[model samples]
Target: MSTPTSDVHATSPAAEYLAFTLGQEEYGIDIQKVSEIRSYETPTRIANAPEFVKGVVNLRGIIVPIVDMRIKFKLGTPSYDQFTVVIILNIGHRVVGMVVDRVSDVTTLLPEQIKPAPEIGSAMNTDHIVGLGTLDERMLILVDIDKLMSSAEMGLIDAVAA
Candidate 1:
């Protein structure tokens, strides 16, 4: 006869996130959404575009809109240096690029390691914030890249199509 055993230590499957920095805060996006990471390059400016929407760059034959995450987040004046990079993302059927200070590393988090985003007051919009992931002493602000890139305020998808 065999005895039954408990699996109390079992954890939910892990999800991977590509970690990057904007200003002083560390943020993460679903690894699957990241198409590629490229070095920073000055993109051609578009008139009447929002300050955050840096401009567009040609990737092969594709015109990709680039947004500076620092400006979009109101993280104060951004300084583009050697560490800056553009994280090309594939959102839905569109491809967009977001400029970040620097990328850290891809982190894997178990379901238990992620906590729901706190409900803050209405002064700030937290719709894009998916959750907070904790690993060791590091905390990652997980963002819903799809929601963010498709939001009307960015006008990224519509602008690209037009």
Candidate 2:
């Protein structure tokens, strides 16, 4: 029988991310960056920000900016509903919320199952995708959240700090 250590060593850290459905495709992000998951809540809008920036919301006592992943990825505008979820991400030392279609369970995949993002045939920009995790018959698009929500893209977070 193979020991757990051997099993763990066989896979890469990318396997630890939580995979979820965005639009019609699957996407994954490292679980370490995820703070909490909540249902969609209307956020207070800020003026003069990028079109994709959803706005800021009061999560408990902390104010967090929310970005619609659909718009950020150029996947098209998203409509908020009960099914939508706010995925709170701690990227670049700032806590921001992102609206996703839904939340899926966390699962692990072997390193061999993950392939670098393909150059073509993707609906949205492939720059943010770190790799593709093939599990069974499904594929999870692994995302680099730090790159997606860089400090430059979320200036408001810094502005509020000053």
Candidate 3:
């Protein structure tokens, strides 16, 4: 008889996720896309940008745009503190940065551990939600950072780099 591992490997592979929080909701993104994590530092504000766009930062010569997930997700106003950190993500062609409440340890989840998220209508943008990752007692909202940043609304960059 074929083992479950054989089937799982054929369909999908285990992947690492970098977990973080925005208000009360815990979220994660693919670890492969994460370039680095830096302490929260105030960025230079830009003119005529969305409220969520906290402006851009100079990271090793590259001007990276910073997005506050709390503000973008409407997860209450984020109080910037020492614990806050910017997750440097290499999504698409743009190396963007996101300000998360705090950084949780990187966790690896098998394909079976990710479950489909229930439809919640337009109240929440589901386009970026890859699935709900259940690891033991904790559940993480898996986010497709690629899609989130590429969406016309985010305006940072494009998906499927040309």
**Which predicted model would earn the best lDDT?**
1
Summarize candidate 2's per-residue lDDT along 42-158 as a digit string, tens digits.
888777767777778887788888888888777776888888999998886688888899888897877777787888865556677788988899899999988777746656545
TM-score: which is higher, 2 or 3? Answer: 3
Writing each residue's lDDT as its tens digit, candidate 3 over 1-162 gives 889876876789789999998888889999999999999999988776678888888888888888898988888878999999999998766788899999988999988898988899998779889999999999999999988887685553221111
Reference-based TM-score of each model: 0.90, 0.83, 0.88
- Candidate 3 residue-wise lDDT at 4: 87
Error of 1 at 16 (Å): 0.4
- Residue 5 error for model 3, in Å? 13
Residues forming the 10-long window of minimal summed lDDT in candidate 3: 153-162
Clash pairs detected, candidate 3: none
The candidate with the higher TM-score, 1 or 2, is 1
Sorted by lDDT (best first), the order is 1, 3, 2
